[model samples]
Target: MADPSNYTYPSPLEGYEGLEPLPDEKETEGPNAKAFINPPSKTLSKAYNQFADPITNDTRGGFDIHIYYLQTNASELKFAAELHERIRREFPELRIYRLFEGPVGPHPIAMFEVNVFTPQQFGAFVAWLVINRGPLSVLVHPNTGDDVRDHSQRATWMGQPIPLQIGFLKEMLKRKEQEGQTNGS
Candidate 1:
């Protein structure tokens, strides 16, 4: 076998020249400076807008952290119970929902839902979960107005991905759209 240190990997963008060249520092003086001096909005960061003084929009505040464990396994159930209690004890400010004994909503396994309203909470909780969530799966998804998209497309999984029953969500969305049409006309 060849020496691994002697081999060099080719750049992914080596042959790809489809993008435009970046502007020089001098070219971004007037408009950029004016914009920086006077921002479009008072709160430009999504973190602030979503949590503090949230603007009425499609997406909701913060994210949902679903901790799923196998109800069949005795050890996993005990661990999940301990984890749930630990989370409640540690992050008392967070809106931690009641633990479900069986599958509920789109979730296919026994799990507990925790709602974090701020970016700080989101970061801290997720980081903690990363280290502590052993032999358990987590589904972290944003509460975008569109539940189907949020649960399906925008979901982030920790460990193995659990199959979600989002068909009901799709039907719910369709019914809502139909109602909106009927009300408008």
Candidate 2:
């Protein structure tokens, strides 16, 4: 073994062994140099195709944001209605579904669904909801062609998360897979 005290230490910048030295201005400015590379296109990022997942082909911002409230609570019901109206008035571009008075699908409480097709839309709506949503629970999940996983594992929540009855979703997927196999055979 080499003696630690006698061994030569490599320079901290040894990895830049053959790289060109920095420009005179950059060297003089040190870390304060205003160096940045602008994107090729005018827009910073792609508007339509954002999500890149190998499991599913839904790359074009396929996501469902469900805002939930208890129908039994009159105040909550009223707030949800007003919230729905406000969302429609503010963001008419979003595909906002009608308010369900009762539990629908896997949701254990009354909720309304809004669909966002772009990263910008998702970001903006979520930000807006974060400020505006009062006493409401929101469930945001991607549509990766796997309903059970989307609702359970990949789901994002705002406020207190309500338990989802995903057993039905699992059953539905199982049925679909069986049907596909039967047809293929």
TM-score list, all predictions:
0.66, 0.68
- Quality of model 1 by C-alpha lDDT: 0.77
Which ten residues in a row are the worst by lDDT in model 1?
Answer: 52-61
Instruction: Give candidate 2's TM-score.
Output: 0.68
lDDT of 1 by residue, 1-185 (tens): 12346445566676547866544334347665633333235555665444432222333446888999899989989999999999999999888888798998778889999988777778889999999998999998877565766687668899999988888667767888999999994
Tell me the tens digit of each residue's lDDT in model 2 across 1-185: 11346434567675558866545443235585566433245555343457544223343347899999999999999999999999999999988999999988788899999988777787899999999999999998888876776787778899999898888667777888999999995
Give candidate 2's error at residue 4 in angstroms. Answer: 45
TM-score of 1: 0.66
User: Candidate 1: misplaced stretches above 4 Å?
Assistant: 1-61, 172-185
Question: Any residue pairs clashing in model 1, and if so which?
Answer: none
Question: How displaced is residue 94 in candidate 1, in Å?
Answer: 0.6
**Model 2 bad stretches (over 4 Å):** 1-49, 54-61, 178-185
